[model samples]
Target: MGLLDGRTAIITGAASGNGAAIARLLAAEGASVALLDIDGGGAANQAAAISDDTGAPVFGARCDVTHAADVEAAVFQTLETFGRIDVLVNNAGILLDTPLPGLDMTAWERTLAVNLTGPLRFIDTVAPAMIAQGEGGAIINITSIGGSLGFASYAAYCASKAGLMGVTRAAALALAPHRIRVNAVAPGIIHTEMTRGLYADPAALAEITAKIPLGYVGEAVEVAKTVLYLACDLSSYVTGTELTVDAGYVAQ
Candidate 1:
């Protein structure tokens, strides 16, 4: 038996990269996964592929986490199909590489809307059902090491993630009474399509690799495994914590 057997999970930004990886892992462990993304076609294709490969119930929907209507529709559709949501992975995020001086209000607002407020809306919508179900649930927020560390050009992205950490803590406490757990996963230097441009530069890649104590770049699956732990009973006693998957980058 798998850890997440019989669970239903909602993963945002699951069309590709870490979100896709997490969805696949969760489904493999017997969770029915709903992949939501702004790229509707990509999400649908991914769901079809996973369902075909694993013979598991996987669904996909077009969702812009920044929009309340989209989130509501997606959640409604997911509940209609899967019955209940047992796990919610808020993995949808954007990186705006604007320095403080060059930052525009629009970009900052958009980043927060997608990265911070988006997760809140989802929790607000789904938490009631999770509470009503009385089986409890897990919520994993995909944060970044940048949230804890100061980066020169990642002001907005870092701020949003840091704010998400705060949300995770507050939500954890608020939901604890109902047995719902909230946590954050902080990743560092994972090689995904979103970071393809940086890894394409050999010098930049080498510089990043050197900083990692593991002497190698991380993979999407590595982060997925961490999410799996938090999604399942393996982390039953863990909540309101930030698990860093950064190869000890934050240690130094």
Candidate 2:
């Protein structure tokens, strides 16, 4: 049997890239999935594609996770369709690469809203249902290595992710009594559509990859597998941890 057999999960920002990878992997491992994103049509398309590939029930809904009403409505819809939510992956985020001295306040605020507040909104909306079920659950936040270390052009993103790490720890404590586990995954230099532009410049990509012990960038699937481990029973004893899937980049 698959690790997530007979389970149901909700994955935010699942229209493409790492979010899409997680959705596909979870569904493959026997979980019915709900793909939530602000991009309605794109999410629908991804849902359809995954359902076709895995022969598992997959649903899609338009949800701006930073908005309370949108997150609440999406949670309700997920419950109505799938009965219960076994896992929640907060994978939605935006990057505002600006130096602190000349950074735009507007961009900083927006980054925090999507990267940090979005996860809080989801946890608040879903945790109650998870508690009521009494079956326990998992919450996986997609943070970045930027949170752990400072990068030159990623001030706002780093700050938001660092805040998310704090949220992960706090949520883990709050939900432990309910048997709900909360954790975060910090990925570094992953090859996703979001970072394709950087890779387009061969020298830049090489320079970045050189810092990693693995000597290469990671794939979305690699990150997805780590997420799956956190979501499954294999990690029953694990909680309030940050799993760094950074190819040893941070070790240097």
lDDT of 2 by residue, 1-252 (tens): 899999999999999899999999999999999999999888999999999999989998899988899999999999999999999999998887678688888889999999999999899999999999999999999999999999888899999999999999999999999999999999988888889888789999888877889898999999999999999999999999999999998988
Query: What tens digits encode model 1's per-residue C-alpha lDDT throughout 105-178?
Result: 88889999999999999999999989999999999999999899999988999999999999999999999999
Model 1: ten consecutive residues of lowest lDDT: 96-105
Off by over 4 Å in 2: none
Give the TM-score of each candidate: 0.98, 0.98
RMSD of each: 0.7, 0.8
Q: What is the lDDT of candidate 2?
A: 0.94
Count of clashing pairs, candidate 2: 0
